[model samples]
Target: MPTPWRPFASYNLWLQFAPPIGQERWHCDMKRGFTKARSREPLVATLLATDTTPQRIGLLAQRGVYEFHQDPLMLYRSDAVTKVAEILQLNQESAVVQERVISILKNYYSNPILFGKNIIKLSRGDEGFPEPILIEQGNYQFNLFAAIDCIFKEQDGTLHILDFKTGQTDFDRRQAYVYLLAASFLYPTQPAVASFYNLENQKWSDPITATASHLNAFQIEMARISQQHQKDLQRYRHSPSEFKRIFPPNPGINCQYCPFNSICSFSELEVSA
Candidate 1:
């Protein structure tokens, strides 16, 4: 018997039995633009096309939002509970996970009081945050999108924006810088102070001062990451199944939380043990 001629033979040789790796790169190669009509991409068309009349586009939109956010609380409201349960095969009604999700939602909903006495009112509207400013610097476009969990405005017109994080993880300086970049793009003239409220720790962190120089550096890093992601997505789309097989699994502790774990051979094997 002769050996088979497989296009990905060389790559598969090294990762024959390894688990799937990397983010799912679905429909990445389609030209950039939002489609009012249904997507023409083969994978997208296959998934979204249905026999139902008038089609459930709103449901599809909600699913898209849930996918990007990956928040279990949001998924529950979006009717993704059954789909998630099928994929992960985990009982969502489990006391531990349910309690954790409830606690997170409570914190998110109580953003204003979470900041304690440091809360400041920025805008007259219920939005709470100051009006966003649009700043354009060189080829970069920055649109500052922030909903103030808490805000404080001074007599001097200096505005402070506070964001709450329910998770125990501390905010990275890089994330602050990205916000600064967006703020600078929106308000070219105003000096803004950005702060993080850690609900779990019950502490308010020192604010990061936004400057033009800092925003420029953040913009460059953002562009680089965006380009790299696009490249990775393109490569994955060329052959998804083959690409998934070739790459060794980059399993994190979070993989256990994934909904698709039941169908995943690697995950099933781990569970059997």
Candidate 2:
């Protein structure tokens, strides 16, 4: 089997060839850890994931977020509704938190602008996609995976790819474009547009159309990055014991969020306020 490299949906720092042997070692070591045991979710992450379960409104609702507003009650008494509570470690405020979460969903999904699309595919996390899209350039092959929030069609048959964002983190357009890149090939017959919608800020980004010219440019860039990653990967594979000198650690604020922060030698940043 060909080793599958992660698709470049987000321009993650670790995905690129980080300078110095230390940072590269850190990146490779973290990936090695991922192949071993799946780490348990930290309490902080569990708390955040539980609180944000309503982001699934896009997948569960008939008309994405709009239908969620119309029938939020329908989602009550469901696994989707209770999974968060179950992960909360039986806190005394579980009931209150559940109610508040429901209210937050109601407020966000109530926007009328979210309606009027004929949506067929809905996904959250890794649930909505099928086999990965293979992006091959010469000897480089990247398996592109996109778990799009919602895939809907307008009256005129234009497909819209939606990505739901709950937090205020700054992001680039690469995410939507990657989604579009995979989707364009997934539904080859249809024209697709991808955009991001922030639930907390209630801000919708301008749609980025997926066209031959646009995707061609993106393909060249992706192929280039994949080739670089391929080279980096070869170094580690050829001299596994020499990874210390090949890939180095570059740690800062981001290390605080990494699961391996405790294990990494350079992890020093604080994650909280």
Tell me, by TM-score, which candidate is best: 2
Residues 141-217, candidate 2, lDDT per residue (tens digit)? 67666667678887888888887765555445777677787777788888888887766567888888866888877
Tell me, what's the RMSD of every candidate? 14.8, 7.4
Q: Which residue runs does candidate 2 get wrong by more than 4 Å? A: 1-103, 112-114, 126-129, 136-142, 269-273
lDDT of each: 0.42, 0.55
* Candidate 1 residue lDDT tens string, 1-273: 953321111111112222124423211111111011114655445543442211122222222222323453543354444443343323434554444434433343344232223334422123333444343336533333444444555456666666555444556555556555555655557677877766444477898886677667656555444444345445556765644443334344434543334333344336434
As for model 1, its CA RMSD to the true structure in angstroms is 14.8
**Could you tell me which 10 consecutive residues in candidate 2 have the lowest summed lDDT?**
30-39
TM-score for candidate 1, please give it. Answer: 0.48
For each candidate in turn, the TM-score is 0.48, 0.64
Model 2 RMSD vs true structure: 7.4
